[model samples]
Target: MRWSETCLSEQLGIDPGKELQQLYLRILRQDPALTLDPPVLATEPAAVKHNLPAQVTSFNGRDWEMIEVREMITEHRLVTLVGGGGVGKSRLAVEVAQNVLDDFPDGVWLVELPPLVQPGITAQSLAKALSLGEHPIVPLEEVIEDRLKRKKRS
Candidate 1:
């Protein structure tokens, strides 16, 4: 089952009975040999999780920009959103991430880099964002890459 459907049924407590019934009826009409069982709700543990900050204020406007950013992220491996302070760049990114959360099987993480004083510790910051501890033998970048590769495969 898709995570969105699972979330809708489990997290939000929105009963999927109507939708399921429609599908079941349609399937039964098409084929009598098929059997449909009630779906079991289970919370699959996320491979990667983040404590994304909640949006306190309502979002306004920027529908087109959000769509463009979402498309860019879907098509490209990397995307950067640049804008001046208080221009809603961070808010926009968070919204986009939330919108596409179900698309990423592993998970979506938000790494806030504003507190970092030096550029050299960027990798460390990323590691912290991913909740990765220091490895005795493997390098941080290699470890991150391997984990990402595994997630992509799944």
Candidate 2:
């Protein structure tokens, strides 16, 4: 479900893109009063489990900081790393994921949500990121968790 289909926009005739930009800023401000009509995304646990790959980087102190963060991710942890736009959070995450992709024998997945507006679309993005079968109806997170559980069991 895209944000365009939400009642808030249809009833109020609001442009969701602008609203999301506003909401993103509001979230950055840590504004407690900011209310989302459909409610903003609920934090979800990181799906990372088991061994991680060695991160080998030539960066200096700042790069080291990002590596430290990537190393510190705990099980079921929901980490929201806030930094200036274009400050390389995505880059760091990708670097870490690439380094550790080999640890996940099933496969490593990178889900990009920048284009997503509706909260429901997150799971879809996850499913797509993992390259699941076309038009699967199961929720993305559930499918991911199920696969991880199977891997752990094995």
Candidate 3:
């Protein structure tokens, strides 16, 4: 823990819970975040819900493309960016995902498909990407689908 977090926690009379709140935070992600200051925590437990990578480099141009992609994603549930490698497809996807993070209360999730070559294991790959390591007795796809279904109902 950072000195700022500890010092501020003590100064504000905060007593952290046993076993830590983070142990079950992914399920706790919802509307109206309740995280305390410093306004932005570097490794906040609420943030653990999303696996989206941070934007490292400065992004420029593609205003029209960004708008189109954003509109498509908003209007349609399944939006795929079809482009060749090195054509900024991934960047556009990340930008759109980041922009729409608040729209999905459950969490904004991204599955990197580059490492996957076999279609047969795509579900398994996605489960791995989601870090859903529940006992194999409960099918991962069922868990993933059930989660999305519940989100859709809300």
For lDDT, the strongest prediction is: 1
State TM-scores per candidate.
0.58, 0.45, 0.55
Top TM-score prediction, candidate number: 1
Clashes per model (N, Cα, C within 3 A) = 0, 0, 0
What lDDT score is found at residue 85 in candidate 3?
A: 75
Output the worst ten-in-a-row residue range by lDDT, candidate 3.
18-27
- Candidate 1 C-alpha error for residue 134, in Å: 2.5
Write down the TM-score for model 2: 0.45
The residue-by-residue lDDT of candidate 1 on 1-154, one tens digit each, is 3565687789998866777767756775876557678788697654545456888888889999999998897775446677677888889889988877778766777766664587647667667877888799998887766665565311
Clashing pairs in 2: none
- Quote the positional error of residue 92 for candidate 1 in Å: 0.6
**Each candidate: what lDDT?**
0.73, 0.57, 0.68
Q: What residue pairs clash in candidate 3, if any at all?
A: none
Better of 2 and 3 by TM-score: 3
What TM-score does candidate 3 reach?
Answer: 0.55
- Residue 85, model 1: lDDT of 79
Q: Report the C-alpha lDDT of model 3 over 83-130, residue by residue, as the tens digit.
A: 677898888888888888777776666765664467637676566766
Q: Would you list the rank order by TM-score, best first?
A: 1, 3, 2
